[model samples]
Target: MGFLGSVCRCSGALLAIPIAVIVAVMVETPTVTKLEGGPTFEAPADEVPQDATEASKEGPAAPRMGSGSMFDRIAFVYDSTNKWMSLGLDQHWRSTLVKDCLQLQPEDKVLDLATGTADVSILVGQQLRTLGAATDSVLGVDPSSEMLRRGVAKVESSGLDHVVRLVKGDAQDLTSVQGIDAAGTVADPSAGAATGSIDKISMSFGIRNVPDRPKALAEMRRVMRKKDSSRVCILELSLPSGETFLSKVARGFITHVVPLIGWVATMGSGGDEYDYLERSILRFPKPMEFAAELGRAGLPVETITSFAYGAVNLYMAKPEFIGASRTLAALQSLVRQRSVELLTLAMLREKVGKRVDAADVDFSAFGCLHFWIEDRGFGSEVNNLVSAAIACEEFGLHCVVEDEVWNSGRLHTYLQAEPLILRRCPDEGTSRHRPLEVRRDRRVATPGWFAVCKHAKGVSFAKKSKFMRRVWRYTTETRKRIDRLNEELRLPPKYIALQVRRGDKVAGNRKESVQITGMDFAREAQKHLSSSCSVVVVCTDDLTAAEEVGRALRSLGSPAEVRWRSRAEVPANLRNGHWQASYNSLTAKQRIEMTHEFLADVEVLRCAEVCLCTFSSNVGRLVALLRDQRTVSLDITEWTND
Candidate 1:
């Protein structure tokens, strides 16, 4: 009988014997012939000879024999055999392995190890092409020359020979094949510098065939870049073991049906090889255990996903450096301290080798905007900050709010924290560096000129309403507090929101502060309170004004309930000096609480049926910017009924 015919014919007899005995017999069998009177070995014409047994006796650290030679005998029918054995699910699985597991990027340089017939390499090339990355290349390496020869033909036939190259190489010894450089040009692999130059490395259904799996894994890690940008993926068949029906069904098919299909496909030439496949699947480690093995190989597994009832698993990992933990901790610390400017300067120095002239750098390419905040009250500063952010976005720059602005009451709560790049002066001891020019001769010149100048102050609010609306999102804690307050107050369904600016505005400039009075607010509230059910919601910095507005509304015979925050509810720290002074003096925790309260008040105003307030109030302008509801803003002089 032929080699595969004997294997199929003996399958029944082998099943009658204990599995342990069968495994021992298979291991002891001489699959290759040793040359007479020499250490050299020989196998079939297509089979690659390995001296693993001879090498083992020379020292205690001998290399393990792999199943590459076994695959060499079945290379011609490997792809067809897999299709039949997998019942046509192989292609679907491979596509998922490429599209999802590998996640090929447009510029990625991929390395496919044990690329039996370059199926994975072709899929990768196709994915890259779909992503409009025709310049990207895939290098496929396999230990079996016959497999590579077949793969080369497939590459040519698919018209991907330009980007997909197949070579005769071992997974454990990847130093032989040329690798792509940073400029995407092929570099000499023999120079040993190509290691860690690859953007991604993938092994599909091939990790199982390697003899020294850990060493092969380490070589894969060595070929991937050390940064998180580089990823390694492994897709391998797994043995199902659970008591579920699917697991039992898969187990039976892998042990019996898979070998039977292989026997028929190769015309009984690959039954023994398929039998080895069944054994290997059963011997392979579990997903978690294999992930641990990958970790030991210097590729810390990032994600592991199983497919088809755990019969197949995909492992995605990145090269782990020894100091990565420390580096991450330090980076987090720097972020908390808002030292992004210093960090950015350090990175700039590293890239340029030395400090370059600020004029030489094109700041626009960095996608960031930097500007100093004027030392002013919270409300004025916020108006400048928000306008600056809006101007930055309009000019195609991402606004990076200063740490001082981030610590303010409402501004900190509303704006996101992004890093800003500060230019360094050539003179190390110089106190001042060149600031980004927002204006030229007191006129707005740049797109983000509004951030530094007063031009187009409300342009963002008018033109970019959608952008302004999304600029602030209440925190989960603040939202919950607002919801609780809303429930407690049981606010009227139809009410008018009234804002009286008194505290700081009256103290600093009575012209701006006393523009509107309690009687003026009561008269405006009456317009909305046409029915007894209507109510008036009052928000003000002055407790006295809030109380006087409630009395004036009642005296006007308006049945609408007058609701306002009582003085007792206001924190004592927030009641002193101008509202800005009180706000600036509060502790961080107290500031957060005050910010939340302010946001809640704004929320009420935003949801009101109609809003009436003085034009000079920042809260009134902010509310008008956020909501489309009817808003009536009277001048400070009009409030005096003059």
Candidate 2:
């Protein structure tokens, strides 16, 4: 009538002898056998050779029956036994874990522990392939050689040998394995020794078998890339606890029918192993209790999903590390909680360090010059901020822009490092902690409020060079993305960079002073289009202007090719006076993409032999500052004059 009753009736003593003998014969058969004349069968990496030709030539040897816990004794029948017992739902469950739960990315590296027959590992490779990731990204590790041997055969049969790998590994002691160091860092020749490299870890019906789950979990956390991005998924059998009828049926199947079927499948030699599974299921902690254990093991449990009326549970977690991002988020929370007055006082104390003479002390706060560009564009804002930082260096005050600004602006995005800010303050929150003051002129100065003053004149060339050097050194991620873009573009060896300023510059107020046309930019570019120039790169906010310059140059019969972001590539929001509005309206991801485009354009301009542009554009100024190439400013008057 029910599932367990049917299994019990079918698995009686009558069929045991023949099934046992078949399983015995299967277990005794060597996965790899010596050939008569063909090349010797050598295991590739941790693979067990399973050539069909070798199997036909050799007779069944001896069954590897050892201890009660030995998996090699049942490796040949493991998948079939489980499939029969679970009614062919084991594969579906594993696939659900990979597709629904893991959601792996293209660049992710997976670690599948207790990878019995590499079923879960192969599934992970399949899922990654769907995400446009390479198949060779998954590494399946297990302790049983026989299991890995069968896994190798399945991998070869499926044509997934290039994508997935099987390795002999103990989950509790993964540090001993090659490519995985004592530090738990995964090293691969293709991916390199990426710190905290492993992206997702999946253990299916495996954690219950591991003697040291806590250590195994710690190992998972150690190899994971980022606490915020990486996940650990554990799927295991559990005893049904609910009072529902289905729960009772599931319980009966696990407690009685599973062991009986396993016993018949192994032909009594390995039947006791099935009994251990039932006992282990009953011994495993409840979902909540297991979640607590996961937390104790240094992983923050995210979700626990139960299937088959609570007979199986999948536990998901991520590493819980107090990284720099978390610290900054906490600091931001603290800033939001406290009043501005208290924050100012805390910052003042942090800046002064020692007691200050209140009378003669100039109360000045160093920060990004956000208030300097009330009527100016983005470039003016950045130029002022850079000047302010230089002035802060000259005046011996710590630049506080790093602490206060949270916007996705040029200064915050481009600068490699930020000035240190005061992390803590006194608990009293009163003037009693303040230094004594003598009578004198007192004023609280905001760094951003002060225009680039006479003090900025003292900023030496060496200091400017040091600041620019640090600011220009891009982060590793940014550099990689830019390099990929460069490869995709395939620019010629020699090129002339042109920065054409139009849009908001020639529209609205002071249009007369900033008036410039596409022909104007084209004429300026023509001056540098010599026989040696291999290409022309035009960076412009206005798509029409860029196209006009391209046509003008083409009509002149210039030998060099013109390269620029196609009109389709540039988002419509970034064109004309709507650039700022569109930028503000963009989602976080879109904003990041826009920023990358801007930075990439700057990098392209930096690589040019000669730069031609109006000084009014910040792109031109930044390009001139970064390179020693001859720059011709089309605008004769100073663009900084307001």
Candidate 3:
């Protein structure tokens, strides 16, 4: 069986092995820094022979270091998942490993053998591109057809296709390969760069997946020059044995929670995929055991560093090159901050295009998308929509819009705080409240054509609260007031509703206390109205402030209604329901459909005749992305109130 297959098969048995439980109960063991030699020998010190009894009584130790079967299984899973699961951590791990490999020579050429998705290949190609390497110079080789197709699409889409090459080839027999240099110089011009011509070679998340790990390792050694110090870095997940309470909890989460997540993501109906994940982790060799494989392969392990409570590890080895590791120390100081992933249903709608078909849908595009917005006001809803829409249109990617408000300094803390925001969103009427497992039903209702726009933005505490209060009232009372207005005046949809606000009254910017700048524009809009338009409905948080501006604009002979809806007035106003509402409603997903029918009864007083809006407002950006009509940006610089 392949490495991953072995892991999947052995996961249940490994769990039963009770390795972590034993370590958890035992006191912390002091680790000896053994850089000077191989693993400390307690039993007979002579180099352990290849035919030693298998560690497990049931079968020969899982295709010992450098075994071919180990990788074949990984390739199988890689083919099955189509490379969806484990992408985030996989990318981060590869990036650190690539960084280590590149330290060999700022300009050295590197090959990421068995490079699934070309994670390592892309990094190496980037280094060559930075040095101005030509197309067809840097290459990535893998055996999986499915993985290659996806990797090729990514390279082409990223505009890196011209520089990086993704090829299907075996790592065990790479003695005949060629190399590309910094300036696109290929030694054997006919068949591409010649064999034994490459510099550094590294594999990430692939070695453990390989079957005959030793032969693959030795093959890597044969393809490089002897005098040249070839560098190779391997990064993989490991369950390190230690007695810290934190590590024990982390082990439990990995053994249990991780598989559950894997099940939801891979096998949504829920089946054996979760078992695959748990099995893979448990069946995975402990850190020292894996390092011992590199020794067998002839690429002696030089150093090992733990990351994320030893859940993952970065192992650096020299096929021949070994020196006091400078970057290893740097890795110790670097900290990983927690970031929430967001997806917008609107964006997903856009990516899947006008029609939704499971076959047409490329689900792999939905990797984790991070949401960031400058303002968390009503303006945020619009901005969030735009970000999601753009991502879906451009990347065909689905996002997980996180409801994150507070910033925690550490990754673990951020994970803990995420649930708080998710819980608050539904109560605020932003989206229906659902735990992560049930949140899929809360997607925003969008047009059929908009299905591809699947990006998500997190709502902050202050903004989400404000959104809930405003939405509840808007749907309930303010909705009715608009209905009454339409019944009384019989307004047309083409009429305009103008929202104006003072810049001074807005909240302070989170990172700095600088005042926002949309107030002046609102004050200045009165002078430039076209004679064709009438009856501007002004929206504002402060009624007194709205009237002051309304009176000033009225002085210029404009016919507009000046009114303010207090936070309390919303419920009553929505009950009247005789008026038209904005295209985007703020009601919770569950309640909105019923309210939408009421909203439809009211005609839009205006179709939006040249909207004068501030750029800082979320409403402004929303109008920019959604409204098809011509709208003008209300620049504050144009305002001269005097």
lDDT top scorer:
1
**Runs in model 1 lying further than 4 Å from the true structure:** 1-65, 134-136, 178-193, 322-642
Residue-level lDDT for 49 in candidate 1: 18
* 1-642 per-residue lDDT for model 1 (tens digits): 699898987996777654443343223221111101100111112222122222322344423436667777898799888876765667776787788767778888888888878899999987887777755378887766667777777777887877887765678777676443212244455533177678888888988777767668768877887666788888888886433445566677788888888888889988888887887787676564566566545565656566555677787777666453335446756584335434433443342232111113233443555443422344454555556555556555556443433344434344433322222213212333222433111101222332234333335446534554666566566678777655655677777888777665655421234457788888877876667448788776566777888899889987778787653555764543245545655677766666656677778888888888765666667777777778888554221100
lDDT of 3 by residue, 239-321 (tens): 54433455666677677766666455544543354564455556665565556656545455656656555766776666543
lDDT, residue 226, candidate 1: 65
Clashing pairs in 2: 135-163, 136-163
Of models 2 and 3, which has the larger TM-score?
Answer: 2
Cα deviation at 520, candidate 3, in Å, is 99
Against the unseen true structure, what C-alpha lDDT does each candidate score? 0.61, 0.59, 0.45
lDDT value for candidate 2? 0.59
TM-score of each: 0.40, 0.39, 0.37
**34 in model 2: Cα distance from truth in Å?**
54
TM accuracy, model 2: 0.39
Question: Residue 105 of model 2: what lDDT?
Answer: 83
Question: Ten consecutive residues with minimal summed lDDT in candidate 1?
Answer: 33-42
